[model samples]
Target chain A: MQDVHTIGKYADFAVGDIRTFAEACGVTLSVTLLSLLIGTVIGIIFGLIRCSKNKLIRFLPLIIMEPLRNSPLVVQLFLVYYGLPVMAGILLKDYTAAIITLSLNTAAFFGVLVHNSILAIPVSQWEAGYALGHGKFSTFINVIARQALRLLIPQAITLYIGQLQCSSIVSLISLRDITRVGQLLSVRTMRPFAVWGIVFGLYYLVSFPLARLADYLAKRIDYTY
Target chain B: MAMIEVKNVTKQFGDLTVLDNFSVDFDHSGVTVLIGPSGTGKSTLLRCINGLEKIDEGDILVDGLSVNNKKNLKQIRKTCGMVFQQTVIFPHMNVLDNLTMSPIKLLRMSKAEAEDKARYYLDKVGLASKEKSRHNELSGGEQQRIAIARALMMSPEALLLDEITSALDPEMTREVLNILVNLAKEGVCMLCVTHEMSFAKEVASRILFMEGGKLVCDVSKDDFFGSVREENERINKFLSFIGE
Candidate 1:
């Protein structure tokens, strides 16, 4: 075993390494934010399709969602990063592939969530809208959407946190995110504990605020209908 | 002309028939109260008239617009405003928004015009002060009043109220019924299904007794209360049970 003094010397990490980790974290955050935006839009559009009464429209979502949900997300990432260029002849940048895979995978989960939330609303709410001479589209957007949002927000936040953490997987495709930076620095510095601890701390710092925001929303919107 | 006409309507929930070839017509001038026990298709009849529940057979016309025709749905729904038993106000909106939504969205009324109309109905329902109150923040009675006001915002040709006061205390029930009574006096065609016997007696021009998805008796207020017809033993028993 190495002496404590030698280990302590390695623990005296350079400030440049910290700066590199910070930059990597910024990349992780930006990718996660962009992925979330993409996932949310895809989720809403596909979720409406899944909830549709039209047989053809409804089946379209099921076709995409079922396979995406059943298969492993990492396998999906690999296919997008490695197999897509060979299969479809469309070359994608490494970051583009990572973002697309993560967004699509998260969207499948969100699609299911939104579909179930729409179903959970009572039939009477729709009836009330119709009885008042509102069209189906107006009723859905004005009435059902508001009620569904109250239930959707908390569950969406929880899924978003999970997705945020899962975004670390993008590092496997050489996306140069915080996890990848940590892996590189740990190997170079030969101090896995010190390097990984800072990485975990950064993740915790970002995630704790989001979790608290979720709690605040849950409490603030609490009202019995 | 009749405000509402149900022509041999048949409504079924799969194998379970709720309304079995029932037919009725209401004149465009007075309050018509439907009295019946629970699950007797009274609510179903109201819902069917407003196009909320589809009829398996026959047709319903609201203000001479056929409810069976998909193209006429918007016009038909516009003619009849319905207040449900449970307070079905949108929980996320304030009273003004709840009242103004249908008028602004459906009638294409401007925001200022809709708010003006909403305030009028709110005042009519004795809830002028509750225009900014959240649906869930108000008491059950207050919520029901807001619902009534919301329906009135459409300036409907007829109103269908399904035991709207059943969930309220007596004071609130009287408060809501008073608004209905005033609307009745103004000659708003109304089809109300309520257990408030005194209020029914006071406002109803015609009383229709329903049992087993059929109208057992369609009698004038004087005839229904003044004469004891031996043929209506079930209705008499029901009325007496409710202390009517």
Candidate 2:
């Protein structure tokens, strides 16, 4: 009886009514993927820069990472969205701002992860590669990177999942993400439990497969000996 | 010119002086064993030749070029190949690649030229067919033979053997020694720093005895263990302490 509403709302929502749900899914996935690509590029660049012999190049990450980690992403998103328009005289979309904030902030995130992964390699491996007459950069790319990749994968997966979950909070600026769509439907239909049930189930559908895929890939990784 | 000249070379790590004003010349085309107790700077001396460890005092000339000077270190390294005790043969590469790397990289030989040269050393070490095998596929002696071949691929004028046989079993040691004998016969000037007294005697044209950090006595194998040679008395005392 508490679930009853008007005839139009009594029936469950149409499949195409889920277009907003589709848009939320597509938007969040697209943003996270772009963020990951950009974040990885930034991280690798700075990570090697961190290992550079030149003091100036090594200190570049210090300038980039400090403010990135200090401020909240919410505030970062707002600053980029508002400040860029004022300075450049060009209006930016919400998704563009979200990707930039996520990419720059997670640059430091992946940078630290990459540094620790590189240092984890044994000194003998370095000696062996050097003995083969590889210069430092060549040795890093050919030998060290291949070894470090095995360790970097799990941390990257964790970052991606976190990014996916964090995408929900981005709807605070009226972005129409999954959670926002669910909230809108609940208010319109006045059926909070059923509406949120559909929302929560959709998220599980997205997240559970990714977690399983990561687990499956983890099992396939060959670190033996 | 001396194949290798080490003059008053000293290496100090903080307060611990590993090699104290050590000077030696490697000129002979045969094994010259450096027999001493552990931590007696045998490996330190070998590393100095390969330009891996820089000496704090004094200079090293490899083939008459100063290894102490950074400019000539690479040139010196290309001419003097070193084989470590734990001579891992690049587990990721096949034996052929392991052998060919130095020739290609340091000697500037083309890949085809390097591989062709690698095959010669491979055959010399009796590993012609095993060239295509991954490093882990070989036995310990086989792996060491591959490592030796890898070192030789540089076509080095001199070789530094640092306790290379100490890790192997007796059978493996014999196999490695046979290869070294062949190398010595080819007139490759060698500075072999090893603890195997018997191998030292069999292969060495000369022997240098060290106690602590000093080369107390240098003698030929004929007089070394046959009759006690002239010593500083400290050498005799230290030799007895080690029960050698």
Candidate 3:
């Protein structure tokens, strides 16, 4: 009873601590941005491949993405950060491993969404282009690819928010993102309210606008079906 | 030689034979109407002539060149324009864009030239003022008219209309049939697959009766309506069915 009371009282005194909060936020933003950029690239490639008629080209991405999507991101990070060096003879720096792991995991989900959006484009659109003599590659690029990008925004933002939250797990890699600092602050201050509130609020600051932007863009993009 | 020759064309999808040894020769001028019961391959025959569907056996020739080769398809398709059963307008695009897309993209016309051509054809179809209106904003009749003008923008030598007015109201059908009559007067070779026997009798220079996956009867408009005993017995029965 005394310990809980003392811990809660002590954090109120240090709620004004700005330096540690800023450091953690800076790290969180960096990881999220890097991870998102890498994930989007991987997602677009595999998403296109999954819809491909060629068996050999399509199967390779399917193998990688399924396990990445079905398994835990934490487990993936451990493999890239820890297991690869031990078994696969590949060594990666902690931050690089975190970026790689986050990207791979996010891409597995992103690829499925992107591919679905592309498939949702009606067959008649392709027929119309073809009847005009547009070849296969040009048809997919001009018709299918452009519309898929426009449709992908809402999904992408949701993933980015997930990515921002997921950045916390990378602290296990010792990169010191915002959530890591909040955890340390909570332990020292023993104030769950002050520490968790500040951390969760900072995350909201990063993610809330993303959700809103996605909603706005999804409404704006032109699509027939 | 006939401009378009379909000889012993057999088309099958798995075990179901859609067209069996179906053959017809569509001349280079005026209109030819194909009348048939449903599932007799009238629409399928029209599609095969333009290479939209490949025949399983035998051959189809447009202007005496084979359409079976991909390399030859570009030149063949350019000469053949098709209006589908349903009004398939590019819904996202406006009336003018619908007319201009193939002209600009396939024919490589300048944007200004394409726009001018679109206006001319849209005016012909009586939708000159609806240039900025999207496809869905137009009525069913208006949409089908725009589809006609879009096909015309390609300046095809031959046009294949697949039940182009079947989905329309009577007034709308009249509007399309009137356009097609005027187009036929200009000597566009037209092969129309339709249930509109009255319209076909009014416009077609020749009429074909299809049944059992074959061109079972072929005759001029006058002889088909005239009293002739040697004319097809199956055709007589089919004609009586329609009359009833």
Candidate 4:
């Protein structure tokens, strides 16, 4: 393992480290996009289900969400990467397992956000729907969900960036994400600080724009009506 | 035939007993003002008719469709439109979209047709030029008028208005009341809950008085203002209190 070094000597390995870190960043971006897309869709569907009047349907998502939310992410990664093959005789490639676990974890959190946002809407909104003769599902999709969207997006985007950061946990299962690439380069070059610093910079490069976009969207949300 | 019938309905909120064995039938062609003190279940009755609140016992029929029966609930709601005490406009929608949403979504009207209809109703409510205005940007009076126009777009057999003016200033209240008066003149069956006694006297065919979750008086407008005064001390006290 490399020792932590100062930025003074980082110049030595900067150019070659750039190539490696950039490629790792590409891998991170690909997985993050795929995970966020899947997570958001699943989150919306399951979140609405979680708020459903049907007792069992509402409870069923919570059963899945509870473990995904409370347990460790690294543990979940291992369970999907290793435990699934043993239990079901169906092995997921390391990258596939990483995507699945990251997406599910993100979905669980986003789903809860969706539920809370929907709940925050006044009951009168739902009554307006009823008085308008919209059925339960239509009322939810058109009336309740539309209003909840303004409340959900700011929080969801913030959590989405958190998911982007948390995606690094996939490296524990050997998926060659930015952190994994950083680790490999760190060992080969014997300069932990330089390697990890570039990795950190790459993550910030990816995340900073999203955070700015969230703020922009939050401002625009006030003008939604 | 009655436009709406509430037959021995009971509603309880954890033993609070908001409406106890309540019953009333609203005629097919008249304005009925439900006058009551606060917490008297008048609003509950309006909500019950619209199926916004469930009755613990008995049946509410709108256009002969039962409010509680699952098969008829949708039709019942369509028959009876409700405007809330609080201004419940969808802040995310502009006035045009607000009026058109249910017509397009529930009535399956084409967007262009719904938009045209929205314009017509907005015109009726004196907001023809405010179609593109967002809900939160409008005055409270404008919002309540838009709410009325939205209900009118559904072409409900009866309208249940729960103190639609409670949040408005007097000028704003008058604007909304003016629209209601026009609807009443058009003979739209309406059950309204309000403290606006003069408007009730001016428009109501029958004035139903409720107190402590029970109907204490159901009289013709003339009788309610005239001879019916001698019938009940509580009614007289309530009328006097509100300066009727």
Candidate 5:
């Protein structure tokens, strides 16, 4: 019998592999950006609701937010991807499913950040606005929101970076993100170590610049009174 | 009618009563300085007058409009311009914008009209050149001055000052107090809460001394610093303790 343990020579990474990875990067970027855009808008609305003076209105977002925040991302992705089709007969594309899951997850975390940021401002600020003859809505828009935005920026950017990494989970749902491409490439080339190392570097490449931008913004927006 | 009337008002934080059946009437003019030990509800009274704190039982009326009625709040707040102990100028805005925002937005003044008024008040506050400056760039005194100017933009019926100079240094306090004295001389209605005895003497038309959420003494300026101080041991002790 011929020796069954003989290993085949591994294929070298080529220019074509770079093109494949680039396309995968595009998917990851789009998913992250789209989710961020949608997430932030929803998050702000949820935050305003969370900050409501009425006790009933304040807890309304928690119905949706709690599950998204408490559960595993993988489980959320699976539910949106597989469970939705079975339970609701809503046949969403894999990309759509990934975006929805990530957006909701991001919204949950971002909403909390926004609520906390608004609360962090001194009540004197609101009193000052009101005393100046502004109604509650005007005070919130003119005074509270402006101040809260400064507090929200650096933290929100950090959250965005986290969401970008979280986008990696979409690969499990067969969304062909960088991680999925890496897995495929590693199998094809028999070079798991090299493939994963490059994948890790790609994520850092995308996230490092954003982290720097957040730091710069944090410093720039600081008030010194 | 009184400028502000706190009628049978009671306020509490949980079980601790801050203001119990507190009733007072502020005249439409003159500076009335509220002096008290901390936690005596002087600030809370000011807050209640402007509809900042809701009274548990009874009514606060500003310009004859009841604070208990939600519809009256906007007018009440507009009439009572409050400056807090901690100077709070809207950050991230230029001094001009800070002064002009409320006038243009709430009062429906034209932008040009608002700017002109802002420039006038900026000059009055000795901050004409600081119009383009942000709140963070100003000294604490300048910020408080700007806060006063912001309140002035509304042409309020009364300016409710809650220890406006307490956060400032001696020099800064003098600068702020000088502005207050000028405003008082010009006959602007003010209800001030302060520990600055000299400022109170110079600017207060009437002095209100509060203790345990009740007004212990309400008298003319000279009477408060002279006979009222001599007669009321509690007032005398408070004045001594605060180094008045």
Candidate 6:
């Protein structure tokens, strides 16, 4: 039929522009990786602060996390990308804006994950460490943290995949990520279906391997005790 | 100085006073068993001596270091190795690592030296072959024995055991108690909170009975198992209740 021929022709057009898509995929990956690294560091610092015994110190993380978590990522992107230049007279490049917004967003969620993971361990473990003459800091790093890693691995993978998929939103800031590249190609060829399908496949290509790595790690640390 | 001195200590959990004006002194080396009805503050006394629980009044001294001072806590804890009823071996580590980690990190012992001591204690507890086993891989009795070895690796002056055999089956209890008996004969200073009357009779040099946060009787084991039971109706009733 004519529809089948039209689909084949659009698919050929999409395949011909694979190099540009590949470059954009590279951009997406780099941005996600950078943000993930920075976000994890920020998240752990805030999570430890959140677990503080003092009331004032424990409240610190919530000041940043509440707004970032409650607001949509798109709004956050717009606020940083568009609002900063006008209000503060400080302009950021599109990539900088994307990375800042994405990292803060990831930090907000990952902070809570770290807090819950640390809390999931029993107080008895801390006591055992202390009974053996370890101080509070030593107990946390040597005893509590190792056990918490088991609780963290599965949830951290889910978060990583989420951040990866969420990075597609960077295209709205004109960062030329894979989604942006897909947008331009679909507009030019008038082939939304074929172009979007390829984008979906590319995202899957990155995510599947990460999921497998998580599986391997989870099994390695898993034990009945 | 006594190995451990509890000088008129009081401890409270919210409104409920667990230990009130309780005092005792442990000599440098002997087995002293604390026996009483449940919730009579025997375990609280052990915890206070180890600096696990803070006392509301008075103080505890371990190896002449006051538990009241923050600076003394680390040294005090190092001198008093505590084993809990729940068998808290670090699950993330194998038995050898669990035994060796504290000595290497805290005492700054070389790994070779720490491992050497760990093997000696592991052999003493009859768990020499379990060095490579994970905590979860061991049975309840084996885990408790490993816990004892872990405590011994630090070369503590005294061991504080709080209801250690309370959670085990009779067979497992026998296994752990056998190790404790051996440790007793070896002249390890031990302050044990337990309900195993026969085990207490066999190993206890002194017996301290408590009730309602007060020391009811402190007697030598023979006197406690003999005359004190006949003299104190409350102690006699408690002994009968526990099927002793």
Ranking by TM-score: 6, 1, 5, 4, 3, 2
Computed on alpha carbons, the lDDT of every model, listed in order, comes to 0.87, 0.77, 0.81, 0.87, 0.90, 0.91
For model 3, how does the per-residue alpha-carbon lDDT over B60-146 read when each residue is reduced to its tens digit? 898888877766666666777888887777765678877887778777899999999889988888888899998657888888888
Candidate 1: the clashing residue pairs are none
For model 6, how big is the iRMS in angstroms?
A: 1.6
Estimate the TM-score of every prediction: 0.93, 0.81, 0.88, 0.91, 0.92, 0.95
Give the CAPRI rating of model 3: acceptable
* lDDT, candidate 1, B63-95, per-residue tens: 788888877887887888899998898877888
Candidate 3 ranges with C-alpha deviation above 4 Å: A1-20, A217-225, B227-233, B236-244
Per TM-score, the best of the predicted structures is 6
TM-score, model 6 to reference:
0.95
lDDT of 1 by residue, A147-167 (tens): 888878988998899888998
Off by over 4 Å in 6: A1-16, A219-225
> A166, model 2: CA deviation in Å?
3.7
In candidate 5, what are the lDDT values of residues B1-244, reduced to their tens digit? 8878889889999998999888888989899999899999999998888888888988987878999898888888888888988889888688999999998889889999999999999899898999999877899999999999999899988999998998899999999999999999999999999999998888888999898888887899999989888988989999899887
Q: Which of candidates 1 and 6 reaches a greater DockQ?
A: 1
User: By TM-score, how accurate is candidate 4?
Assistant: 0.91
Per-candidate DockQ values are 0.73, 0.28, 0.36, 0.55, 0.61, 0.68
User: Any runs in candidate 1 off by more than 4 Å, and if so which?
Assistant: A1-12, A85-92, B228-231
lDDT of 4 by residue, B1-244 (tens): 7777889998999979999888888887788899888998998888888877889999988888898887787888888888988888888888999999998888889999999999999999999999999865889899999999999899888888999999999999999999999989988888889999888988999999888888888989999988888777878888899876
Residue B121 of model 2: what lDDT? Answer: 87
Chain A of candidate 4 scores what in TM-score?
Answer: 0.86
Residue-wise lDDT of candidate 2 within B1-244, one digit each (tens)?
6788889988887888888888888884676888777888888888877777878999888878887777776677667777778766665557887777656665678999988888898999999999889855788888889878887877677778888888889899989989998888787777888766667666788888776677766888777765654344665665566566
Better of 1 and 6 by lDDT: 6
Error of 4 at A182 (Å): 1.7
**Poorest 10 consecutive residues by lDDT, candidate 4 chain A:** A2-11
- Across all candidates, what is each one's fraction of true contacts kept? 0.81, 0.09, 0.16, 0.79, 0.79, 0.79
How far residue B232's Cα lies from its native spot in candidate 1, in Å, is 2.5
Docking class of 6: medium
